[model samples]
Target chain A: MPATRYRAAPAATLSIVSLDLMRAVYHRASGRTHLVSEPVPEILAALADEPLDEVALLDRLARDYAIEGDAAALGERLEELVATGLVEQL
Target chain B: MNHVFAVRIGPVGFRVGSDWRAPIDTLADLYRDYPAPEDGIPDFSVRLFARRPWRRVLRPQVMIGGDYTIPDAAPLPLSLGLLAAEMGMNLQMALAQRRYLLLHASCIERDGRAILMTGESGAGKSTLAALMMARGWRLMGDEFALVEPETGLIYSFPRLVSLKNQSVGVVGEALRGARFGPWQRDTPKGDIRHLVPDGASIAAMAEPARAAAILFPAYGHAPDRREVAPGECFVRLTQASTNYVALGERGFDTLTRLVRDVPATAIDYPDAATACAMVEEFAA
Candidate 1:
């Protein structure tokens, strides 16, 4: 069986503003400001340019960051982004 | 509605109508320093009237009504009519102000720099601002700080300062010639008094200055000060704003610009002097 693919929503726009110790995402479409940190923003940056399936997204992330992560866990994070309407299943 | 008075406070104008003439007189005397709208049109209307037809003559409960009012809001006795009028004006601004990003914060200015202070209720923002006015800084606003989205400039909304509980006496000594409205005991916010801001705020109400610093103040604590990171400041400001959600993308741009452009810090103090000194030092 093949896993479902995901991509960034057309209307969703993200602006990552950095502070001393934290980063925030301004979701233009949702009108919601979110506080994010570390690897999450890195994950968001990975997903922001283009969408990828669970395995492909993790592979993409692994190339840039030394993340010893699992596909299932990475997939869960993608689902959270999906819940926030930042990305959707292709 | 017997008496109707139109006055402009800062960028917004209000036409307050009351069933009794007393509230109007009190408003006029307290707001004597404020200028009236030039064209005679108000951005919002505050109406203080009795709900039931005979309630005016019976219990004399005055219900505060305005451009936007809660249907089930309880009434205050006639003695608190001034309180009702002021609350009505604040309600209108909170619910209807849209030209700028409105924050539930106090603002003071010196030498073209504006310092914005916001926090939860009883954070001593009002008390601190009133004290600053008594010193030398111009009180830009006591309740709502209006920030222009394009320029990131803070405008003056120097309405009457609402001093609650013991802060009333604290402010009483600071005011030089300004007199507070009659003290009313046992309101929702404990003993309350309304202090009119100094004439400088009124004279410079039309002026706008750059936002230089943002401070989140907490009262009744040992003196402590810490820098708030951009993310923390952004979230706190969104919570502080009265119309952030309504302003949408404009609000996002403005608030992001504010945190990026202006420095933010949180200060905790047990007394007004320490708080003032901390802010002055930060501003310096």
Candidate 2:
């Protein structure tokens, strides 16, 4: 499987922490240690050592997650995650 | 007139009172909708009295009140809404007592095993629970579930799945015979409240079953995608738990006891129907 791309979005700090609370425990038990949440295992794998911007994040995920066929679909997913405090706008 | 009512969230007793009567009715209605355990008489207790200056206190055991007067023994003075919020917090505390812990999430059960789903308010937790219930998963509890500490058994509470704002229609479409109460306006959480079909054994829902898996559900802008990871699921579950602070020495034991024995996953989907299908299929 290819890497998953994660987008960091603007949201309340509490929302971010709440997601972190879930992501942190999930990562800890899996032994996937990191300074923060949002770069899920799949996301981490895709962009290893290479930082990608917002569009790149979506483009990479569209290809890797098999979420193809519509560029609009990619934009929507990025925006949705941004709303959910999962991804950020650059 | 001050309206005071007592209801139990899992093992804790929460009494909420305010100058207004609607909150009491709202809470009482919430409890009445889901019958209590015939065996356990809600040993964990707390009393919230509403006065001009509402106060809340959490003693070693319970929060007692004497009308508007704050007794010297009262631990904290709280707002009326704070008393209401205690319902969730008390549930969290009670779950920490046993091997089971409360997650800041929602859960639905099928075949006696729980599929835990969690997310922030708008992340679609309630919507997912409602959809799964429509498709055949037993309504374990909405927004909160009580799991057995030692056995990872999820005790069913059969409570209403609270949907907020726009998600109400999303769930209604999925559930054919959904029932909803009148919408209350201008509350802290905004316009909300709806009731899914009452589970067949709601009155008998205290029966506990092992928690088979935990799924962190996320609704994507797209509608058909599904991702499943049993290993990562377990890891996320331990993180969603609310009692990690209270479980202490027993935290590791309790968490490992549950996660190591069961599976966990992260569920990302586009719509309620697809989400429900994925949950039911996985539980099956």
The DockQ values of the predictions, listed in order, are 0.68, 0.02
Q: Taking the tens digit of each residue's C-alpha lDDT, what string does model 2 give over B161-257?
A: 6677777777777666666655644446765655644645364466666677666677775544344443344456556666655554345445555
Q: Write the per-residue lDDT of candidate 1 for residues B82-102, one digit (tens) a residue.
A: 899989999988888889999
lDDT of each: 0.86, 0.53
Interface RMSD for all numbered candidates: 1.6, 10.1
Which regions of candidate 2 deviate over 4 angstroms? Answer: A1-90, B8-14, B17-19, B36-41, B44-99, B176-179, B186-189, B221-235
Model 2 docking tier (incorrect/acceptable/medium/high): incorrect
